[model samples]
Target: MPEATPPPAAGLPELPVTWRASRTRAVLLPVAVLLVAVFCVLARAMPHNWHTNDRVALVVTGLLFAAGLLMLARPRATAGSEGVTVVNFVRTRRLDWAEIVRVNLRQGDPWAVLDLADGTTLAVVGIQPAAGRTQAVAAARALRDLVDAHATARHRR
Candidate 1:
């Protein structure tokens, strides 16, 4: 279990806190951007000897860069006073913080999972373990803190 988050002193924004996939995945956005730029530059500099297959290759490269950008978008979640949003590859889920029972990132788990009090579990694609154990654990701990703080604040009100 993680320790509690210290209360903010004053004049702090509490409505939005966003979490993303591991650093490994976060790095993809820039890399994909770079690749697209490089491909465009190379293609522009050397359009000679261009064949039908060359066009195909260019299309394929563009698609690859797009895919990389999509990969970067995978597994994102955000929290606020009201709820949390988890955006996975295919779908997105939003859950009120009060509905969440626990957040887990066990050994060998690909991503974080939120176990609801209702007994159904939802995978939080944002907090992934691929970045490294230390980082992943820290992320999980931070998430727990947010959940605890918000839930407690809600109960007190």
Candidate 2:
């Protein structure tokens, strides 16, 4: 497991901070996975002689349920001195600070959007407005500050 924020420093800002998912996800994901696991386990322990189709169905269902659990982890964006790491529902990306052009968190938007220099954008889904106004805004500001701090340092050299 990666640390949310790196060790405290004297003057420089810390590297490696991550935006996590909502509390709802924190609570629901484990419970759902546990339930599915328990169901599969119990089915396996049943005394009845299971047919090949039944076993296959059980395996398929378990796999599908596990796949769905990935979303519960939600989107996480981690910032380090070298760059940013975005872990979305299905994919992960790493980009250096120079690749990012701007941080955008507009009203009515669900989360912070990072406008990349490549004419594309990256959504910071871990900092969702659905979590709460105060939290969402604070997260956006923190991310923006991180980007600004790095950008300023990079420009100086």
Candidate 3:
């Protein structure tokens, strides 16, 4: 039988901090703005026979695009000794290592759920498996390690 490699040690291992893709915002913003401007121009230049639905569609699409663009432009994640910070555009949540009960890298939206001592789950959004399998796993392991270290340190204190 061939020998198998040993698994890496547990707890938040040192990792090169990585910033998730903000490109979605970068591309969306300009397109949204341009779309809004174009719609406005079209509405003004067209004859009175223009359909109301056209105007409504333009406004709704523009609004949706603007919102998406704004979201992408902001910071997504920052990992440190204390914990990982995640920003979901509308709100921001910070999870300390001690507060996290388990680190799961499962199917669907790739996220880390922090099971706080209080029993609430804080979802960390930016760490998606769709980003890349290797990178996602590495990040998950580092986060799990962080939680382990925090728990150990607290018990020792």
Candidate 4:
């Protein structure tokens, strides 16, 4: 069993709250740099008999790999007064407050999932446990509170 979260204060959270996976960026950024460095060194060290194309290929491959890693670090979510904008690895989606029915982050889940009124779930990678368990939970809770508060306000209007 779990305790209920209190309602957020009126006009709380101020709007445009943004969440990002800092840990993901921290780890991948250095790894990408290291990878590119290694590729450059390898390119320079290729056998004298090897063609220039081979060396170029190695460096190009490394750049592509680094780009992919950086993409994984690109997920973010921003909550504004009108809606939440979720940016995942390859796509971005915007959802109005009323369109979100629930926010869930169960144990073992990779990230927070927003259950939309349309019966679809959107994974919010910006609030992932891979960043930090406590941090992820807090972020998920805050987003949920924002959704709840907005819904309540809408109903009263």
Taken over the whole model, the C-alpha lDDT of each candidate is 0.74, 0.75, 0.63, 0.88
Which pairs clash in model 3?
11-145, 12-145, 12-146
Flag clash pairs in model 4.
none
Candidate 3 segments exceeding 4 Å error: 1-64, 72-75
Cα error, candidate 4, residue 53 (Å): 1.1
The residue-by-residue lDDT of candidate 2 on 1-157, one tens digit each, is 3323333434444666777667647776777688678767866876678876786687677767766776756688888867889888778899888788888889999878999999999888877788677777877887777777667766665
What digit string (tens of lDDT, one per residue) describes model 3 on residues 1-157? 3222223344435532544533455566687788778767776677778798877776777777666766755535676655667776578877655567877777665555556778777665556565566666677777666566656666765
Best by TM-score: 4
Tens digits of per-residue lDDT, candidate 4, 13-106, equal: 7667899899889999999989999998999998899789999999999999999998998999999877899999999998888899999999
lDDT of 1 at 139: 72
lDDT of 3: 0.63
Best-to-worst ranking by TM-score: 4, 2, 1, 3
Q: How accurate locally is residue 92 in candidate 2, as Cα lDDT from 0 to 100?
A: 87
lDDT of 1 by residue, 1-157 (tens): 3223336624333557677765766577777777777776666666667875786687679769778677656877887656778888788888877788888989999888998979999987778878666767777877777777666776776
* 3 or 4, greater by lDDT: 4
Instruction: Rank the candidate models, highest lDDT first.
Output: 4, 2, 1, 3
- C-alpha RMSD between model 2 and the true structure: 5.1
